[model samples]
Target chain A: MPLGLNFTQIFLHLFNFLLLFAILYFLLYKPVKNFMVHRQEVYRKEAEETSQNLEKSEKARAEYEEKLAQADREIAGLKAKSGEEAQAHYDRQVKAAKDEAEKILRDAREEAERQKAAIVQEAQKDISDLVTDAAEKLALHQSSQENFEKFLDTVEAGRAEAKN
Target chain B: MSKKQQRKMTVIFVVIGVLLLAGIFLTAGASAQEEDIVTVIRDAVIHDTNKIALFGLEVNPGLISGLAVTGILTVFALIVRIFVIPKFTLVPGRFQMILETMVGYFSGLAEDSSPHKNRLLSAYIFAAGLYIFTGTMLELFGIQVVTTAGHSVALPAPLSDINGAIMMGCTSYLFIVVGGILNNGLGGVKGALKEFSLPISMSFRLFGALVSGAIVTELVYYYTALSYVVPVLVGVLFTCLHALIQAYVLTMLVALFYGEVSEPSEKKLRKLAAKAQKTEVRTAEAA
Candidate 1:
């Protein structure tokens, strides 16, 4: 064959190569390619699952933080409310005590005034009675003193009659 | 001299003496030959004519070699599929790593060329690359078979035949056409038509490169004086280089052209642009 170029050989070579290509494509290329694709899909699915898990955990963490913040706000509000209520209660207790002390002072003053008035009244009555008894005793114990006191009274009466 | 240095020097002298004696014996054997040795440059061009009658049809020796290569590849693929692939883990083993590297390289090439149709093209390119590489390197084994002329001939690389190169080139062209059609319909076919000479050029290129190596190696072996050490060096270097280079060139061309044909049509691109412009105008008016 000149230059090894034979039409028949060329045709045969083409046929043989095509056959080989077909066989290899089916037997080797297709299966290996499918395996690689399957492995890639597995890796992608794993990555997607990991990403989803991360998202869920992040969402849960955010919710927990939000709840914690709300609890703190509530605690703060409760603390302020309790403080205000305690101050009001303290003020109410102090005002009530002051009113009770003023009432007690007024009651004591009234009682003392009543007792002093009663004691003064009793002393005045005793002094009048004692003075009356002293006059009666003097009249009984001294007859001359009595006569002189009567003569003085009669003379003083006759002079009064003459002048009338 | 010290004792140790003297002993070392004696050992060196003994080795040199033995080498000189062997050289003298070789020269004597060579001079004793009665007839001068002459190397005849046999026609080492690959031929498809010698028909091995397989079920009544004349078969080419190159075709037989191609079939043998196919068989070897099949067994290797099967072994990898059955034993090697199953053992592969997320962290790859050595064999698995090699396989992955090969697949990843081809797939990456396909992706770079044709992003949309990379999946369809990667398999064919990988198959073509493996075929070319193995077929070219197959000649290195020097497997001999008796021809129809009752002469023993070394099996040649399949691509050394013009027919095999044509087939591969045409097949790649076919893939380009199909890729275009799938991506762009009739427009894709029109795009693929532009590369009608691709197959012919590709075929000749592959055939020429491989045949040239064969021819050069044959010429080297033809001279008796240059035959012994030079032929082996020439043959191995040429074969390996052709195997790697031809495989890469063909696969690269196919991927590059296939990517070109599979792109979106100009009309479609224009429509998208117009739609985007309209949206922009409407938003501007609203603002």
Candidate 2:
């Protein structure tokens, strides 16, 4: 027959186990549990914060992208507007210079015509006066012989003066 | 549908088929031996240094194998490591910000536990605990697969074997070492030891409770001539309670120990940080 474990021995053994557990529970178990719970709570709080941060970052990213797009559009629009303004100013300046040149040419031509007309009139008047003076000297020489002689002397003298 | 989806579906099917085949093999093997797993656990407990009793009764081998203490710890560790830890970690797609937050929080924990704001010790403890628990549980479950798959492979005994004792001992030692290292980094070796004692008890207390619970369950079943259901139910209840209580207690003790260890060094560390901050401010002002 096997030496079976008696009921009393078994009972005592079990009781001893429980007593050990009770002691450990208080000394080790309770404290450890509390620590774990505290850690877990801390973890949960952290997790919540992390989730919020992630959401915030995502939102910030979206906003940034939107702002970037808006900035790009604004920059492009300004560039186009500035380019058009600059081209317009250049074109206006070129057109004004061309008109000024035409006006100056017209004024210069008119002034040259006026100076040429005055010179021609003066030359015609001088030519008529010289012709009349020459005719009068010839007529005086033909009037009388003695007077003609004197006139001839006068003509010769006039000739000598002209030569000198 | 698409090629990719088809490929995924095929992979899924292959995995399912493999799992089914493995399950069948395991069941066939188990049916052949039909030896109760609980018997092995009971014998193993008897061999351990911890002689725990429960409820004024000694439990049987059947209960021991069915409700093993180390096995429970392994399973819990696995679930937390594989499921909970990863969920908390949240890499790649979901909650990357959350992961960073967790990292920052643990970094703070490291600062609190150490004298010089070093996170090495705290991070190491967390990772080691996570890994140890995960590895042990996976090993246990992997052993179960063999048992069920018509394989003759036996489960590793937790007691009487040098390996088992070493593994369990190392686990406890790791907790102690981590605690000590954190304090040592902060307040020197002597202070580390003071802090290490808290975690040592944390690890040992669980083992004690588990052993006690198992022994008691066996005693009740055999001595009192109680109904089969009653013993099993009581054993399960006590075992769960013991595990829960141990986990909770260990956590609190470690946290409190952290607080205590960090207290003395506070003044010196604060002064150093303040001086550093002041220097930085002055430099900035000058610049």
Least accurate 10 contiguous residues by lDDT in model 2 chain A:
A1-10
Best by TM-score: 1
TM-score of each: 0.66, 0.34
Kindly list the per-residue Cα lDDT of model 1 for residues A44-162, writing each as its tens digit: 99999999999999999999999999999999999999999999999999999988888888887887778766765555455445544654565577667776576456555544543
Error of 1 at B135 (Å): 0.7
What DockQ number belongs to candidate 2? Answer: 0.02
Chain A, candidate 2, TM-score of 0.60
Stretches off by above 4 angstroms in model 2 are A1-164, B1-186, B195-204, B220-227, B262-267
Provide chain B's TM-score, model 2: 0.45
The local distance difference test score of model 2 is 0.47
lDDT of 2 by residue, A109-147 (tens): 887877666655565455445544654766655566676
